[model samples]
Target chain A: MTTQTANIATTRTGFGAYVLALTVGVALLTVSGMAQATVLHDAAHDQRHAMAFPCH
Target chain B: MSKNLLSSAVFAGLIAGSVAALLQFLFVIPLLLEGELYETGARLHFLSDGMTQSEKGTPGLGGEWDRHIMTVVFNVISYTGYALVLVAAMGFAKAQRGLELSANSGLIWGLCGFIAVQLAPAVGLPPELPGTPAAELAPRQVWWLSTIIATAVGLSLIAFARTGLWQIAGGILILLPHLIGAPHLDTYFGVAPPELSAEFVTQSLGMAAIGWSVMGYFAGYFLSRSED
Candidate 1:
């Protein structure tokens, strides 16, 4: 019973970690996509236009 | 443990992104290029003096290759990011509320995502053309972010809340941001013709709606398959 509980706990921890990573990854991608920094803006320029986000 | 979820989101993002890019290439880009011509003074909407003006030549494929490639790559990446967020939200809903995340249901979820992320906020701030002038960016960004969060939370409550009171609260949340209003300029200052701007806004939103629907369906489909 103790072993089974430990296995379940480990699975939950692993799942939590995966979720955290995904959240961070997506957040970073979104920020960079919207960032005003020259390189990032240029990289995402076409997308910014395509999405109709305000770009001068 | 939830590796399948991540993989499924990636797959859905790729498919949805490709679809969106193709649609934009076919429909949106031409309008955008035409708008740029007006912005650059190459294309005049109406003559200031009573003189017949020659039509401007169409922009050729000169240095747009690099930009075009970047657009495809960025579209895929951004859509994939959006899919990740949607899938993560779905996972949370399933874990917490015992909600089923199947393809058909994903369609609804995707539409909700579109409303929260695109449609609702767009009510105040319609899509702008390349040369369109606007208010300060910082305030606009703040309003946009707040509106998206409020709408998302409001929508989830409406969908998942069991009580009528909670549903009413959700409705309030959805409307609160709009009530506050999005930042806007006192005067309209745009170089592009009003008709062109209006058309751009409509086309942009229409494309977005389609993209969101496709992404939602595929994300849900992949997640359901992964479950099995």
Candidate 2:
């Protein structure tokens, strides 16, 4: 049972899953933090300022 | 495996992001509304024209429900995204270094997050009020991105490296971007008063500190729970 559980744990902590989390997280953050479209900028203006992202 | 990771990110992001949004409503938005007036020429500071009208600071929400709603939405998304990144990194640390993830460890991660994401890059590009002058967008963004990347790598080394040489390399990484310097306008100028600008910087960082810390806490909490 312990070995079975360890296998499960290791599979969940595997490289592929972590990479997916990182890639998606980074993509979302870029949208929220660095997107430059005027509409997106307008929507996120206060947030940009608050996050200290470069803003005009 | 991915399911567990995704669930943890989603739940933690939602709760922590809401907390961050509430804090923004309480502190960040009013000052922002006031600053917007300066941006639009509704209010003027350092009066070059010698006009004598008092600043009409935003004392209320002013019925701009749409804008406020947008602010709340954006705050949630931003903080959630931050949580995802932090939790993913924690997962890596757990796998590679045998580090434990828990609420307490998450707080330290949160501090590191704030330092890497906001505080470090901010040394070159401090938070700007709406009307504050800044360098051209592209260069500033480039500098900002590089600075955060360097700081994150440097911080990881400092936190996890076993050797003095590796840690020293990390130290150099942290300083490298600042040494390169952030792109800035050749001359300093702005439409907002210096005092308001300074307060914005302070309050913005404070709010961010709160946001990142909470996000880190929950990210650790949820990820650990899901793994078990």
Candidate 3:
């Protein structure tokens, strides 16, 4: 393949890698968020609002 | 693209996501909570009768780790959303052009995500800790500055290092959520406190952007080094 064509091929391959990585990253983020929801809710929840920074 | 290249990119994404999540969890949250911004903002909200704290508007310290976990959880949710968007974008683009997503690209992408998603919604939502009277607009401002600075530094490292394409993808993965936007209180209130509400959206979006950039840089480094 010509030099430019080779470069294009390289880029395509790299782009594919990026897409796949993005998929996995999303999955991890989702799971992590779910794992910490309870803690976030407890610390910042409505009932505790008064103790923290009551808005109303 | 070859299987090796694809594998590296995927690996980079995972690394970037994780790093971004950790930074927010371990560093950003604590800084915001401890800084004067929190107190000043909270005080403003308290004055406005905007918050309803159990302790008569006292901003309690819920252990340092409490904030840490909150940051972590938030980052995770935000990053996950970004990843989904990336997948869709890639599918639509249909033409893979690069082996690795550059660090600078990741940061630029992050800014795009923040503006499109978080900054827009913040136009109506408050930034105070929910149920608190504290205005928290100061901290929100700080958040914006911090996000920009952090993303710029992290993405630059990735771009210059030439580590791998995966890191770039990871950055993009973290960024997508900010671009897509997140849920806020604006949907409920008609005449919400302007400053507070606006700050809230911007801050949330900014945090996500920072996390994504960090993830992208770290992931790129890790995956690029791995022989697998």
Candidate 4:
């Protein structure tokens, strides 16, 4: 019982987990936002297809 | 030189981000799909269909799955930003004394942080997308209430589950900007549909809260175990 409790308790110790998680979080925001923004801008580039002109 | 503080923050951030993302996928996404909030809420329908319509580009569930994956990816990324801030806090808090790293306290602080940063912004801020005329002006109250509760609860889990002084500090720091409020630029183009805005804001806060909570929980978990 004591060993189990100790193991469980140990899980919450130290600062390594926190910093690692922080880095992952920051990376996700920076990288993914850029990726999505790039995709959006490319779609809006207006060169994908020629606009059909209206004939009066 | 114990790397306890720095290491803990990183681990906690990932755990929190994952947990928050899962919660979002499970409860929040379903709510968003089924809720009347989007139907009645302000929404933005972009003229150019962006990544949201990728399914049309590729055949079958690939597009559907891709979008889901994107949601998880984006959610995690946002949390990552929050985590960086928490890391700085841990380093600072480690230098100080008298700060208790109790799980319960962390949760309370996490919840308060969510309210300060996310909810407070809604008071004067207009919805981002377009929606039905009625909802455009007065959205369903569920928009605010549901989001607030979801976010508070999600973040509290992380805070309450963790253990450490620095962990506690990191948790609070993660939430600081939202609590004090982020800088905003007025006169932005496009707004969310009424139904979706409520859902999106709630989801945004929920994701953020959980991300911070993860930082707290893991920080506490690792710090308690590390040899001091």
Instruction: Indicate which candidate wins on lDDT.
Output: 2
Sort candidate 3 into its docking category: incorrect
Model 3 per-residue lDDT tens digits across residues A1-56: 58777566544444545566556545653344222366545543321211111122
Comparing 1 with 4 on TM-score, the higher-scoring candidate is: 1
| Residue lDDT tens for model 1, B26-132 | 76776677778888887877567945344533354347788777777877887788888888788777767778879999999889988998898789878776777
DockQ of 3: 0.17
lDDT of 3 by residue, B1-228 (tens): 444333434444455445664544343333334333444454332334666332222233466665545544444444545534443333223343334444444455545544433343333233343433333444443433344334434444454445667567547644543464433433432222344434443444455466555544433343334322
Q: Residues A5-55, candidate 2: write the lDDT tens digits.
A: 876765556688878888888888888878888999888887788788785
| Clash statistics: count for each candidate | 0, 0, 43, 66
C-alpha RMSD for every candidate: 3.6, 2.3, 11.8, 13.0
The two-chain DockQ for each candidate, comma-separated, is 0.38, 0.66, 0.17, 0.12
List residue ranges in candidate 4 displaced over 4 A: A1-28, A32-56, B30-63, B122-196, B203-211
Candidate 1 chain A least-lDDT 10 residues: A9-18
Q: What would the per-residue lDDT of candidate 2 be over residues B1-228, giving only the tens digit for each residue?
A: 566667777777777778777887777777877888888987777576875445645665578778778877877777777777787788888888989888889888888999999899888888988877888889988898888889999999999999999999999999999998999888987777667777888888888888888878887787677655
- Look at candidate 2 and give me any clashing residue pairs: none
Residue A36's C-alpha lDDT in candidate 4?
A: 35
Angstrom error of the Cα, residue B147, model 4: value is 19
Stretches of candidate 1 above 4 Å error?
A: A1-22, A54-56, B46-63
Model 2 residue B119 lDDT?
A: 93
Model 4, span B1-228: residue lDDT tens: 135544554465556656765775554554444332334433224325462211111111223555556555554444445545454444335434334554444454444644533454353342232222223312323333334444444454444445676556555644543464423434444333334456645554555566556555555556444533
